[model samples]
Target: MDNGRAAMNLAVLLALIVSLLFAQQPKQVVVTGAVPDAAGGSLTITGENFGFVPFVTLNLVPLTIDAVGGNRIVAVAPIKSMPAGTYVLTVSYGPSPQETGSFQLVLGDANDSRSQSSSDVPAPSISGASTDAAARVADRVITVADVDREWQRRDPAGYLGLIRQLYDNRRRIVDVMVADELLAREAASRGLTTEALLKEEIPKRTITMPESAVVSLYQSLGDLTRGATLEQMKPALRAWLERISEPEVAKMNYVEELMKVSARAEVFLAPPRVQVDRTPQDATLGSDSAPVVLVAFGDLVSASYARFAQAFSKLTETFDGRVRLVFKNLPLVGPGSIAAAEAAQCANARGRFWQYHNAVVLPPGAVDAVRLKQAAADAGLDRAAFDACVERRQYQSVIKDAIDEAARYGIKSVPSFLVNGRLAPDPPPFLPPFDFLKRVVEEELSRQTRKP
Candidate 1:
């Protein structure tokens, strides 16, 4: 009887312990509101279960956190002059960095009288009233169409940029999936595993780099080698080179052969295109009526821009009369960037824009007043007139206007390209490869031909 009583007591204790453990577990975090300061320099986020302190990012860029409480967080934006648009605010916390929630943060000009306070702004409705309505705010019904219409009306370019980004992401994923399926089917047809088939085909397509070529690559490393001799780094260097080049190249070549030559895979997915207007102020190359107009936004001092410039030069040559290259200044980097852009404009007035542009960008150096003057000489410009134009800052307004236009198009980074009014879907800090640009130009040409 004592044992039976003791067992019942133990069971009761266990139940109590389990209930306590469940109760102690933290509630799932939820971001209820985000409010930008009047100056738009700081953002305050209100949420539940932020877990002491949480890491926050606005549009994937980490914010400099200012203050954190259990239910509130304040952080400074990365960009001081953030363009007015809808931004994604993401929060993550805990030891393993579990994402708490994502909140949509709509913003307007800070000085705009229409800007509302945190209390005035409507919270996103969590529950739907009916199938037709997206949300119910008290007695008022908000439909998806209504939300979209309002968003489009407020910022058409931002809305379109978001849509294009979404389409590009989806298209990229679909391409990968289709390629995977094609490979799987091909493997099955050969009565071989995909892995086995890749192993058989990849080696045939791989190129073995010669010893001399490897040495040349090592010499090109310069300071990147960190005082290490070529002989000391030879094996590792070869391995690194092979790792970056061989397998990927072999795989891509094989996939191209399968898709283009063997299976003749056709992707009918149409890419999203925006109407990018050209102006007389734009410095351009090639015929005005060319089917492919490639508008390039770049900073003169940017290394990425330089790389893209080289590719652009090659592309113009390859396509000849078919492609028109338009250059627009987006001077985002360094103190000298704006000056360089202005100087380029001065060069443009003297019919030396391309020559001066190539001299400044094609070389690896910081652009300054001295270099600008020297480039003017190299480009066969009237140095006295060029200097005068730059001194007066004749094109400052033009550069400012260009910057504003870039912001309107949601372009925040340099080396951005728009091919025939369609923004090239390449992520920042990297330019599209020459082959990719060629393919885009070819596709644009084909598209134009199909048009009645």
Candidate 2:
């Protein structure tokens, strides 16, 4: 009987201990409220059974506790220092812990909440509510045709914009249609084809772009090129910089040398005073105080642009601080080419336009969205930001206006130059392309000096 009584007492004591332990166990914490999408704001948390001093963690990093007493605790979110993304917000109570739920740590200023902007409007055309459900049942693999079809079906405006190249070729034909019989006859008399002369003379007059020079130019461009190297981009770099140092190294205007003996080819044409100097916020190179300014309207993807850019690079070096060149977007090739122009503008936003200038050849087959992002990655740009900007088409109107203005100027070709308000004719026997440009700038300088 005594042994039975002892067993009962022991059982009762065990039950009491289990009850005490159960009473001490902490309650599940619920994150009831968090304010402001990103960091740097008060986060309100509540859990009735929490210990006097509970701990809080954000994105696995322990945050400084402000106060933790009662059923509710307030903790300050990390000071917007954490990168922008969705992070798990965990609140722990007492010793026994359980974690759940997340808060999206947004990017950008919290105070500048932009609900009133025009972008706030509902565009159900892109809402794609159907895609949310369709994605699961849709083909796991997407194809070119699928993307194209979906793109056209989803964004009809985008489809129309892509089809409409702002620059029309017929306008250029009319501008150049004045018939250069005199220039043609002069060329024939000299037994020179402007094309053939350049083909032969470019080699004789142009210096090879050295590996060091190429590397120097590439490195000097800074973050725009990112981690690109001379060897990897050698062919493209060589092509762009090939003639940059030629005029300096050769120390002779091969065009002037030829022009001295031949009758001057005078095609009296003036570029319409269309606005080329857009703003200081453009991609530019050379001295702001220079006497001559070159407004270059060139296509990034054009083979002709590569040549023109090289020639212009030479002028910048040869002109003795008397010239400034501004690059205005004239994307005439197509949407892909226009997209490439937009990519350059995106880089410009980051002060990496020169690097992007050199890496104009880095994009994939064409400057599509995927290719532009890849190129941005290759260029070491903030791909997320760049991709977002491209999607927004922030610079579309700016580019379109430049194209429209080019059409107004009757610019139909890839690389058209305006030197101090004169439409620079394509190379004739007397003036090679670069030399003609140099001559125009010098004449402008002379005129500027003579102004009384």
Candidate 3:
């Protein structure tokens, strides 16, 4: 009997100790409420055991309470500065917390509220009910043609005024067309119709777009349109936005007009046109029988040179021997730098001209005597032959002849290409490069075939 009583007492003590341990642990509670403003606005919090001891965290901000006497506590929300724009209020206590749907904090103005309400309100539309003012206005103009219908509307001034605005808008459009016609007539009378307005204006008005601006604009379009492809949209959008925001709109308008004039005007290029003598007279064509001889006038040192080379190479391949590429080396390294031109000529002699050409033109290497020799060796040219050519300055005359050729073609820059014997003004946009070159080559070839 004594042994039994002792065991029973021991067991009772162990149970009491376990119960105490459980009781001493921290008890968690739910914190519920709308975020409160210090300015007399109350956010109702619905949760249990929001006690005064420990602080409750709203978002990442901590809110302290004196006590939670009841399950429902109206904690006057602290003067918390919230982020601008819309956000969901996430209320929490302890480790795990809950979110209280979405809430919005707008510009603290009555007008903003009114605008929000107006946006929410349904307005009649030509297609269906609309909440957009711009859409509604556009629809009303399109559908409501009858003057009686316009007058019978509840808001007479609003509706009739809108109608009148539409009429006036159309009248202005007609006026603009008439003005354009008159301008064209005047240009014809003055012999200005033959010249392109865009061509004339771009050089005068084109703001050299900052590199950062171009990149930023590219990124912005990428973000907005999702899949609209930057190359397709960038030039047009950049011109449009810049025209509206920058003070350079007039210049842009002039350039646009020049383009329009160019589009409408007929171009009569003479046969067997004197191509730019930028390259050497002995500058061999890629193929003897290739009818389309593309004479590329560029310096290997110019960035535009590498760009054009890549484009021209693709064009050569696309045309499949029909296009013979002849590069004219116009060595404009700077005011008096013939070293690069001399090096390019030497490379040409070694049959590794293209290889050395690309190396010097691209970034990441210096174009000097030693570097040029190394580049030639790297391009698989015979070292001794390459060095001799450089030392002797063998192709100086050839280089000069190339420059003369370019001058004859009226070429002034590196990478200017002559299609057949005629000059093409710009490089094809590189996105679908092969297709573009192929199309041009095919068109030119077809035109030639039809001639005879």
Q: Whose lDDT is greatest here?
A: 1
Q: Residue 157 lDDT in model 2?
A: 41
| Clashing residue pairs, backbone N/CA/C < 3 A, model 1 | none
Q: Sort the predicted structures by lDDT, highest score first.
A: 1, 2, 3
- Which ranges of candidate 3 are over 4 A from the true structure? 1-272, 275-285, 335-337, 362-371, 428-440, 450-452
TM-score of 3: 0.40
Candidates in order: C-alpha RMSD to true structure: 19.8, 29.5, 24.2
For residues 1-452, what per-residue lDDT tens digits would candidate 2 score against the true structure?
A: 99999999999999999999998655565555554323446566665544565555554344556777676667776544554444445554332323222233444544455534566576554323332433423558445456657876776445433433322233344433422343344457769875564555557776654455555444434344435443433333333343234543442345444434444432232233333546644677789888788888887776557545666678888986889998877887787888888778888888877676666653323344565565676677887888788788888877877776666555667677777755565543223456657877886776666523
Highest TM-score: give the candidate number.
Answer: 1
Better of 1 and 2 by TM-score: 1
lDDT of 2 at 251: 29
Estimate, for each residue in 323-408, the C-alpha lDDT of model 1 and write its tens digit.
Answer: 99999999998668999898888888778889999999888777777877888898998878888899999999988898888877
Deviation (Å) of 332 in candidate 2: 1.1
TM-score against truth, every candidate: 0.61, 0.39, 0.40
Candidate 3 has an lDDT of: 0.53
